[model samples]
Target: MSWREEHRSNLELKMGKVVRLLGECEQQLIDETDPPTKSRLKSQISELKGQMRDCQGDLDSFGQEQVTQRNLALTMASVTYEDINFVITALLNQRMISIDGQDNFQPTNPEEKMYKNDLTHNIKFFLDMGLAKAGEVRHFVENNAKINFPDVPERLKASLNTEYIKLIRSGMRGDELFMHLYKFSSHNNPDPLRQAAGLAVLCYFFETCDVFEP
Candidate 1:
């Protein structure tokens, strides 16, 4: 097993022990009539539950770290959409993002709060790579949406638009909305490259086609 998987296994085992201990403490408190002893047991149970929560959080972070590693691997590609995503998110985060559309000139009309501060880490995470070759992945995506990778724009919009709007209307924060969008597009696919592509598609749509107004 990978070290992360093994570490998660160990955490699971530790969590199991904490749960059993918590159960025992609760049972002891139920049976013990002594007030001070019951208070001590209550405190112990609370601590055990906190340990369980921390362990679960560690386990969750480990899973996300695996995705981070996978995306890091994708950065080695000659042309990377992550760079495109970085540019768009960084511009939005800075309140200076603008996009000229066919006629209306979208100007990336996002709610100020949706972009400022919300995408700092989102931009930082991709910038952390600093390995993405300077390329016009965004321009490529825009130009070829109907020619080279014809399916991408249509398919991405068809797959994501309605839910993207729903998520925005639901008042979900930007980063959280992106996570849900990523999972929706990725669909738990196990392939790393596909995951990267899925993320690129989502980020691209975020810039051009989706509703970020709420």
Candidate 2:
């Protein structure tokens, strides 16, 4: 099996053990009446809960990575409208677009046309031109993944749309815009898997496509 698969399997095993232990600890808490012993058990339970959460998070990340890798590989091998649709669907499901009362990273369209049209154009551009160089996709993914949008300066946020338009007009193409959107989405959602998936879709686009210029 691949390292990724093996890692996931190991995590699953570890999670199983932790879950079993947590159950035991809960039982102990119920059975024990001594104050000092109960306190110790409670502490252990809390620690176990934290561990479980960590394990779950790791598992989730692994799953997202797998999906992203698969889709990227497919896109690189075969550039097609269907693959593009897949990427779009993944982004939407991951909340890269807005929902009621929940802000996302979707750019404000100055034209005010259908949002999907803008997304489609951007995604197609990245697939066609953004990944022209070796390792470009990897670099883009690494850099953008590190961004936490909430920590950005308020001044920047206030003029994000204007700045984005300027950048687009000034030769900023597919990969760059995608990264911007991905970071914004991640900041709003605060879910690692969802963010990873969005990035993966963009990476897939970057990996595919024959056209290398805007």
lDDT of each: 0.49, 0.43
Q: Can you tell me which runs of candidate 2 are displaced by over 4 Å?
A: 64-214
Candidate 1 stretches greater than 4 Å from native: 1-117, 120-123, 126-155, 209-214
The top-ranked prediction according to lDDT is 1
lDDT of 2 by residue, 59-175 (tens): 668667534433332233232223333433333343121112222233333223213224443343222222221133333333444674332222222233333444566876544
lDDT of 1 by residue, 1-214 (tens): 9997677656655654564465457546657999999899989978986886676567667677545533343332322344344433332232212332212224353334246527544443332222122123344455667566665444445446556656767988657776776665545445554444445445445545343332
- 178: Cα error in model 1, Å: 1.1
Give candidate 2's whole-model lDDT: 0.43
lDDT (Cα) of model 1:
0.49
Which candidate has the top score in TM-score? 1
